[model samples]
Target: MSKDRPAPGDRIKPKKSALVQFTATTLQLEAFVVAFAAVALYGLRDSLYEKGPLELSDPNVIWVVGGVLVVALLVLSRLTAKPVGLAGGTVAQVLVIATGLALPMMYLVAAVFVAMWVAALRLGTRVDRERREYDAAHPETAPNV
Candidate 1:
């Protein structure tokens, strides 16, 4: 059986949620950075004791902690499609910033990501709101489908 393709304008447009999209993007990027931080910590493993400020007794500590945080971030990325995920994402952001305590340099990284998260929440919400209003005004393209 042959199927016909819809005209370009007749094709269904998916309803994209700005908040979820932005939150996922932010979490995914943060996950990548956290993964890199794990690798950097592995490189610094030998020097940690000499530096002596951190009490990490095992070299694998970074891998374990960073891995968990990365997983949490990735999960949060999916969860953002829901309302509860917004709060969860905020909590995750705090945890990411807290990494600054163990790695002082993470303060810079944390600040940048924190700013991005805040911007995502603010801007994404605004965009979503505007999109809803537009859809409401023009109902032809606003069906749940």
Candidate 2:
């Protein structure tokens, strides 16, 4: 058998480095955050209408619109690259914040999501840096992919 060939019963598999894995995970988490917010707001639409101070007869409109926007942005973020994903996440957070105008509780929810977004970006960057340093120090271990 050739040196490059795997022996019988062996399988060749593509390997994702830590940096790639972390980046993918972070993006997915960001998307999930917005998606969760959309679903939650939609679920609480009736409650918000009943308890919120908004004078509109159909407060569910706000919830539905916001949910749609967040869900759309989440889909776009997942389909695009890092910059688009980050921007979409930011916009989704802003939408969440804007919901505070209708229901005050959204302010707290927005803040929590914002915190999570920041943590994901910062920690993912740190992980990327470490992965780069490791790759630089040990080039042989780096994956071809």
Candidate 3:
């Protein structure tokens, strides 16, 4: 047996699979977005209630939510350093912004925004995993590899 190999009775083992690790990293990236949304919502709630300066009423809530969605999308794109989900995210974001302006469709806007963000997060996780696997498989390759 190789000297570096674990003994037959070794007790330690890693609990997480690659999927779990990818999920955890994706969630970690989203957590920052969630935190930022919470802070922005708390700070601007009064202004989004139709009585604020924008006069957009409930529409302002959409703005706040959309803002968070966009920021989160940007962060994910940057973290992955890939354009994989950017186009889809941008489309969803545009839908959010437009739907918000309609004033009475806040729920739909929120739902779509949430769906898009989740999709983007998943895409990021996949990208991260694929990249990691590629690096592992090509560990010793130079530019020609």
* Top lDDT prediction, candidate number: 1
Question: Candidate 2's residue-wise lDDT over 64-98, tens digit each?
Answer: 67557656655754543457656766666677677
* lDDT tens per residue, model 3, 101-130: 433334464564566556655775686677
Q: What TM value does model 2 have?
A: 0.63
lDDT by residue (6-110, candidate 1, tens digit) is: 433565566688889999999999999999977776777667333325555476788899999999999999999888788988999899888766666777898
Model 2 segments more than 4 A misplaced: 1-56, 59-63
Error of 3 at 133 (Å): 1.2
- In candidate 1, which residue ranges exceed 4 Å CA deviation? 1-11, 48-53
**Candidate 3: where are CA atoms >4 Å away?**
1-102, 141-145
Give model 3's TM-score versus the native structure: 0.32
Of candidates 3 and 1, the better by TM-score = 1
Better TM-score candidate (1, 2): 1
Give the Å shift of residue 27 in candidate 1: 0.3
> What is the alpha-carbon lDDT of model 1 when measured against the actual structure?
0.82
The whole-model lDDT of each prediction reads 0.82, 0.59, 0.48
| Between candidates 1 and 2, the lDDT winner | 1
